[model samples]
Target chain A: MLRLADVSKRYGPGHWVLDRVDMQIPPAQSVAVLGTNGSGKSTLLRILAGVTRPTRGRVSGAPPVIGYVPDRFPAFDAMGSLAYLVHIGRMRGLRTAEARRRGQQLLERLQLVGGIRTPIRALSKGNAQKVALSQAIMVLPQLLILDEPWSGLDANAHDVLAEILDEVVRVGGSVVFTDHRESISGAYSTLAYRIEEGRVLAVERVAPRPRGVPMAHVVLADPGAECPPPSRIDWREVAGVAGVRSIDEAIHVQVHPAACDGLLMTALRGGWSVAEVRRDREAGRLGGGDSWAH
Target chain B: MGALIRYNLAAVVHGQRYVAPLLFFGIVLTVFTVNDSGPLANIYVVSASTLLVSMCWLTVTILNHEDPVRRSIQSVTAGGSSRVLVAEVVLALLIGVGLTVVGLIFPILSGSHHWDGSGLAAGVLALATCLFTGIAIGVLCSRLVVPRTGYSLLLALVVVIAVPLTPGLPPVNPALRLMSGNRPAGELLYPLSGYLVVSIVVAAGCIALTRYISVRRE
Candidate 1:
């Protein structure tokens, strides 16, 4: 278990690049570090990697056996991929043979068998990223800290990374990774945290918008002809339809974030009719209809 | 600890690609030999030049190549202190042994000089000392603002030129001649013991400094 409490960092004494941020990741769990640029995402990862110093904070945990994958690939010029991995493994106390064996295996697994003997300078960007990722997870570290791990990966490479991460988590390892892309699935389901203006905010739950086809469909009424299909109207643009409550015969009831009564009253007066509407006072359950029901 | 030293030495020596160090070694020897110097002067030149070049090679190997700071931190976090220690020691040994061989190889191979026992010992010591000093210098450079290879090349160039220039100073050359102990080149070169002592002390200081820096900054 890794716990960061009251962690803060300031460049000089002026603005805090990272304010008092608190976070915890349980063993065998995976967390996504989400934030806009300059949100202290990289800084936080560096602090955990023991690269950057936090100005004021108390971090508690075993010097978390952390495997760090930096955003930028810092390649060693002369060494080949095989030599690099074995060297790192040996540095971590494996025998020369063992290190070499592990290196070869990881290289092959990452589909870089051809480049294992090739110099690092000669490798392409994707190949180099594979090398970097393998080195980070070479020793099976307990805490894996990755920054922008999926930056340039194609679909296959992304899948391979996901497999690697899944294996890490399966073995009771913890992970914290940051990425700008949000469409990457499984991030919302797992532990998610957002960094805004140097403050780390923990997201307890991420309720994803209804996927596939939302069963609780929305119907808009013209009160003149038959209500148009739910697909015809852009659900997002229509003022209160986004927070859909429920569906009745020809009426789509929605709970507006601010005041629902005004829009409902306007719709009623404007003769954009609601054939049926039932609003729960406290629960805010708006029973609305599907266009097919009429 | 001894295992670590050996591992570091092996890694350093073997870190090269397809006899790359031999390229630099040949260049240094060729430069002096191609000049007006005879075989005898060339042999001495080889010893001094190897001592100078080996240090620079070791410095780059430790800093830019392996990057002790990043490797050490990675290993520690990976729960492999023993491995990190071994790699470092092996690197140091590789530097020392590598220089020693390069220094003695050309002299013995070319039959340039018949080394009496003291001459051989002094040559060995000088090579070892130079290598040790290089490792120590590399450790210091890791902490400083300068890039590893650049700093090492600059230092090696200065040492190669400056050490020889010390004897050319008028008032000091006379006194320096007395303290020369009959071995003019060896005395002109720094003492081996001094290099060894300096390497150990400096390496230890560097390790401490790195740990302090890492913790303080973290």
Candidate 2:
């Protein structure tokens, strides 16, 4: 378990990269650090890693052990990936022979057995990242700190990395990681937070991007009434704001994406009563115009 | 203390892989004959000093750097006290003594009875000075560079500086006497025990400062 209380950090005495970040991570849990570029996601990771100090607050609780994987894995010349993992194992207090054996096994599991002896500097981006991750998980610390753990990984490698994460969770370890793309597939997260403007905006779930083509149609009551003009419809008033296409009398009205509730309310208030509303499940199907479909 | 020692030892052994063998070879060869001592004398001094300093720096810097920059180890260090950190520093010093013994054993086995206790102690002191200095710098450098590189570079810097300083010993500079507590000053003021006292003081100071600064950064 890890608790960050009133944590805040400032680089030059003024700008706070993290301000009053209060969080609790229970044992055997996983939390993803989400944010735009410069959103303080990495800064939070650094603070957790102890590489950077927080200007204020305290991090306390269980005698936390960490398995840290840095963003850029700087490898030495002639250093094999397997050898690297073994060294980390030894660092974490494993016997030399055991370290070596585990290192070999980790490489083989990651599909890196063939490249075990290859100098780390020579591996591809994804392979190098795997080497970095292998070192992080080798020790199985109480807490695993991973910065962009999924970067440079191919599909298969991604699965391996995800499995490693699942294994950590299964073994009663806590994981805090930062990633640009969604990596947790079909796994229910214990806690999720999105960082924006140096603030962690906690979300219950980060839904997947809508699949397939987007379809939406707005139904107007009184089938014989003529459709409202484009200029008068005020498409900008919608939240999801798919453009408003022509409304065919006694038939259908086309819309891109789903219409915002506010827009629907506005339409209702404007004396346009809705008979029905249906949204397209596919993402890109609302072709050729930015208007809402009825 | 044992955990810290283990961490340091592992990092040095593994991290050395990143550094080319040519670098070590060059360092050992260069340290050997950089002085006015004859070729054999130079060989002896360089070999002992190289191994001693390498082991010392490797142990000290890696231990400090890995913990401070690595989230796993950093949490432990930050969570612990200066006392624990100081224990780690002392362990490195002990290792320094061990390396000096190794250096002495090498020459004695090769049939050089000229290995004096005072000289061996002096070498160890010099090595200790370098090792502690490397650890101190590793603590400071972690603020600037990544953990692994920060420590490796700090060790490298100490070795570079030691190349010139280790060879210049008591003969080239009078300050060496201060390090050994062998000055002509009153024995009461600077007794033989003074050397150990000074070593402990410096090592402790470095450890505390490193711990304080690193925690502040945290």
Candidate 3:
């Protein structure tokens, strides 16, 4: 976990950029920082990344392997995309061969292999952003911090990055990012914070879902007389069951469609027979009313 | 720190900024060889001064290329700003020494006059001191001033004019005094030692200043 206490940043004698901000980033959580221009969102991220120091506060518990992507990638004009990624990977403590291999893999995943040998200065804006992200994930950092990571990415690349973030969280890594696009924040963020007048305030806590993937609602037969009660079962231990609730003789399990099979297997192993499985399409849809249908 | 040094060395080499300094040294050596009017010592002095300017120019350019903002990021990523600054300073010194060695070789290759081994050693030491002093001052100025290019160019110009004019400052004027043949061996040792001590102090002071400013701003 990363914690910030009474963190404040001021430049010279000017007004504070961040005022008494306190935040905790726990493992396996995705946090979204939101604010208007000059509202200290980037400053907050920088402090978290240790790229900047707060004037009168303390920060602790920063993980050793942190992947940070600033708003703009620094100009490594003389270095090729692959070389730059390799350099960053090496800096983050990867062995030379491993760094090279990972650099290749990240660029390929971002669809930037065609320009691997091209100088960073020559890459297009969106492609350059991909390079920036490639460096951040080269080491699969335990704590990944990004500032406007989705700003210049194309549609396909956007989905690719979302999947990567999801994988990072699934493996118990933490992600903290800031983005202006509501669609992005709404889709992947588990917690959101708003920066208002240099103060950080918890705005909303979201229960993240797999985007565009429907949820599965399963009904399981009541446990036999010798078996434990359904409520006594720890559904969280099931591979894909996100949540479990028992209603009368039936048990309702919420899970991603991909995890439906795993959920059924776990239920059967626990002495509960599976009765039916159906897609909870309405529960999976975002927003509400007619607006969501579109 | 090793990675930073390797990255910087590769960047400097691949960027081809070293070319301009080498070319400048070559031009100065060729001009002296063609003219052949002045004393051999005079030729060496002129060539050495040109090398000093080139070394300072290269240091300033490489350091300025990474703006303070970028440096801050590098500092945090690399664990601290001191490591990054040390790597940069070491690269600058290595480049300066390499250029000085090449400059010293030019006079020997020309065979215009018999060169004493001690005199050659003293010349290289003096040139290195001058280069170190220039880099320290240049880094300090680059951090304090905006439009780094303008300030760096201005600093280079000042060093070129001031080093030859003020012969009392041991480090800055050693090359001039040594080339003139007026100073005895005993006299030269005192100034050379002073130059070494002053160089260390200046480099340390500048690095400390850079760190202080960087931390405060961050």
Highest TM-score among the candidates is held by which one? 3
Candidate 1, residue B155: how far the Cα is off, in Å: 5.7
Candidate 3, residues A199-271, lDDT tens digits: the string is 9998753345555566677888876788676545666445445445567877766665656787787778777
lDDT of 1 by residue, B1-218 (tens): 44445434444554563245546766675554343323232255455545545554555455444454445445444455434543553565565576567566655654545444545555565555445545554444443324445764676466544543575432222222322345444443345444446556655665556445434534
Highest lDDT scorer: 3
DockQ scores for all the models shown? 0.25, 0.16, 0.27
> By lDDT, is 1 or 2 better?
1
Encode model 1's per-residue lDDT on A188-271: one tens digit a residue: 126778889889998654343222222222234655546433323323334333233234445554433223454455555555
TM-score winner between candidates 2 and 3: 3
Q: Which is the better candidate, 1 or 2, if ranked by DockQ?
A: 1
Quote fnat for model 1. 0.17
- At residue A142, candidate 3 shows an lDDT of 85
Arranged by TM-score with the best first, the candidates are 3, 1, 2
